[model samples]
Target chain A: MDVDRLNLPSDGDGPVFKEPWEAEAFALALGLHERGLFTWTEWADALAEEIARAQGAGDPDQGDTYYQHWLAALERLVQAKGVVSETELTERRDAWERAAHSTPHGQPVILKP
Target chain B: MSHDNDDHGHDHRSSDNHWSELTLRVKALESLLVEKKLVEPAALDAFIDTYETKIGPRNGARVIARAWSDPAYKARLLTDASAAIAEFGYTGRQGEDMVVLENSAKVHNLVVCTLCSCYPWPVLGLPPVWYKAAPYRARAVREPRAVLAEFGVTLGGDVEVRVWDSTAELRYLVLPERPAGSEDLSETELGLLVTRDAMIGTGLALPVASLSKRGCP
Candidate 1:
């Protein structure tokens, strides 16, 4: 599945708010970063480097290329550094199947496992 | 803490709160259509259709919030997000082997449909109307910084951006770190800290201690 989200507002360069949902997500990330868990500077640098690599590789997406590189970078960090484990991915997948198959009423179904 | 505008935080506006008084009109239409047989039992298919066609990234935002708030679950999510999200009872025909990319000091995360917009539906619900807007799709992948700037997210030259090329086999979501000083918060409160921008890796979560100092109730 492709992950395409909405345009969220920023503080300095443009609109302060865009879609309500994206705004909420932005608030959470900002909160996490400010506490020194991670720095936006590092995030920006890594993503830029990834984008450059992609460009060198002849990416067709071009300048408008958004987060694809970022996602891959995150994966590299997680796997390389063990931020999160691969086994976790498998366990969660099994749990999700249990939850998805059991929930009712077209709402989110919390998994029991 | 106070918002830039000095306003204290507001409580979450639950889905229930959004129903308009004119909702009766909507109900009336639904009944009218049903009675008129404009749609049949086969019409339930429309829920999936409408979700696929009309709903936007807000749905994805909701899913991200849930994941950020629940660590054990989030752990499961990052590992096999598609299945974990499916446990919540939302499944999009378009969603599959989903991977959640988390924020870290060395890496930043963002997602784009390199070929076309192939978004995860079950977890994100639906792609926002603008996501498919050619201008946005073209502009987002082209000048991410410039585009992100329009979103009010400014990254200095020191920051690095990594864009992912989404394929039919892989789907991605940005799993931003949880905010600090909120170690005591409930799942709901933690969820309040999540934002759509974080999921797309354009922004960060809000801090709770700072929020507390600002008279957050």
Candidate 2:
């Protein structure tokens, strides 16, 4: 993975994935890119647009919310490329929330069919 | 995890709930993407592992320590940072274009990414939260003296302060002056004196006296 082309918020080590979920979001984007869903330039452009939009919405431009913007950009890109629909994403998210509530603390939240 | 939660029962639930939504969202996205055959679970694990276990400030500390003990290496570091750093096998990503700012008794170098958190990842690892926060980004260039003071780095009036702004194209690392009385220390021992904040120019390298007090032989 030529992560250099991503233009992600990073320090000396590489990309900064502060949490497990942040890393997952980053990998998802990379995975999609690897599968030819989008080019690195297109991904960069989408992330840039998301950051600009968030700034416009008074997001304070704090670094902690960086991954949130990354996630949003991924979502936007996947939908735009017809890889996944917004409706499916929304539905999946809701299902996850329901699964999480029903699952006990420390238990894995498995979405049941 | 269970033991710590038992000790701090009140704080546990909030921490769990805080990241729950974001965690679930990512899980949801991953599941959806995987179901669509767009992403693989193993690939995600590999990416996560790379960032989590590998790369950090220890790499930069080694570089700084070598420079301190070897003048020739220090010259190469200042002349061509990227190549010199590559010698340590720390080349990739944000560290492609590197600049080593040498700090001296006469001049102090501080680094910041005013636009965003662009750093030399091959060396330093992740930037601290404050380094990426709004206040440090805005004030690092405006009144670096005050910022340094806040970080407990009080510079004399005679010392010149230089602020280096890191970008996506170019990143800067401060080669902090070796503390006095460290002449006898080995290169590896000297590495222990190098702190992440020192390389970032927010603090100085640990003094030799402090090392001895910490019981280092």
Candidate 3:
């Protein structure tokens, strides 16, 4: 797929994924976009909104927190597009936290049936 | 949440730590999206892999090295960057439109995306954090010489620094001047001297002496 418009943060080699989750978040946004959930313009707008909101909240605007804004934008767009609801997102987040706690150290967190 | 420092002692995991929270949020989002069939996990992996492995500055390095070695290729690159870059099989995404800025004795070119981080992903991959940060974005256009100095690049007063602001439609790549005393180096070897910062116009290509110092042949 031609993701002609999407721009991502990177270093010399490529996109700088400081953490595994950062890459996952970045990819998830692309995945949703590829599925035609929202246009690249919509994604850009949502990301800009998140960045502005963070700045308004006294975020230093340093590069370190970029992906946090990215993740926020992805979540916002997914909800705004009606692909998922706020309640579902919150419930899923809480479920993941519980799973994370019960999981062994360094083991993948798995939601129980 | 206070079930810590008893059994595991020093090994207690800060499950609520900032990164951990982010990790959980991403996991939750991915899980929800997958379950809803809005996004496939394989597609996500493909996107990540494309950026992480397939695309990067190395592609741009080869382009620059080829330009340095072949006059014909250089002409094509400067005249029609997208078409020339396509010859190397690097075309897609942010690279739909491209302009190769040639650095000469009298001129230097630097690229910045003042509005967001629009970059040529096909060649240069994603841009560095500093490129997207507020400081570089504001200062690159205002005080380019000072910005270049911070990146350890110092040009003479005779040189004019031209800053190119990249947009979603057009992206710029700096074709750094080839270093002297390296005419004998093959194109592949020349590519090894090209750096990501050089293509971004933040630094210069490595000289042959430095390569030898680093035990490179």
Model 3 chain B: ten consecutive residues of lowest lDDT: B10-19
Q: Per-residue lDDT of B1-217 in model 2, one digit per residue for the tens?
A: 5684465655444224333778877887899889988888998888667656776899999999999988999999999999999999988542248999999999999999776566787898767667766567778899999888777799999999999987666789999989998999999889988988899998999888767776754
- Tell me, by lDDT, which candidate is best: 3
Q: Give me the runs in candidate 1 sitting further than 4 Å from their true place.
A: A1-113, B1-41, B44-70, B156-158, B207-217
- On the 0 to 100 scale, the lDDT of residue B27 in model 2 is 81
lDDT of 3 by residue, B1-217 (tens): 5784476445455543223888878888999889889889888898889888878889999999999999999999999999999999888642248999999999999998775676788897766777766667777898888788777789999999999988667888999999999899999889989988899898899898767776754
Pairs of residues clashing in candidate 2: A11-B121, A12-B120, A12-B121, A12-B122, A12-B125, A13-B121, A13-B125
TM-score of every model?
0.47, 0.77, 0.86
What tens digits encode model 3's per-residue C-alpha lDDT throughout A1-113?
11111122223454367889988998987777777787666776677678778878997666678889999988888877778888988888888887877676656667986
For model 1, how does the per-residue alpha-carbon lDDT over B1-217 read when each residue is reduced to its tens digit? 5458533564332322232222222222223333444334244444434543454455555666677666688788878877777776655443257888877665666677643455665555444444433445566677777766665667667667777756655778887767767777776666656666667676677677545664666
- lDDT of candidate 2? 0.80
TM-score of model 3 vs. true structure = 0.86
| B143 Cα displacement, candidate 2 (Å) | 1.4
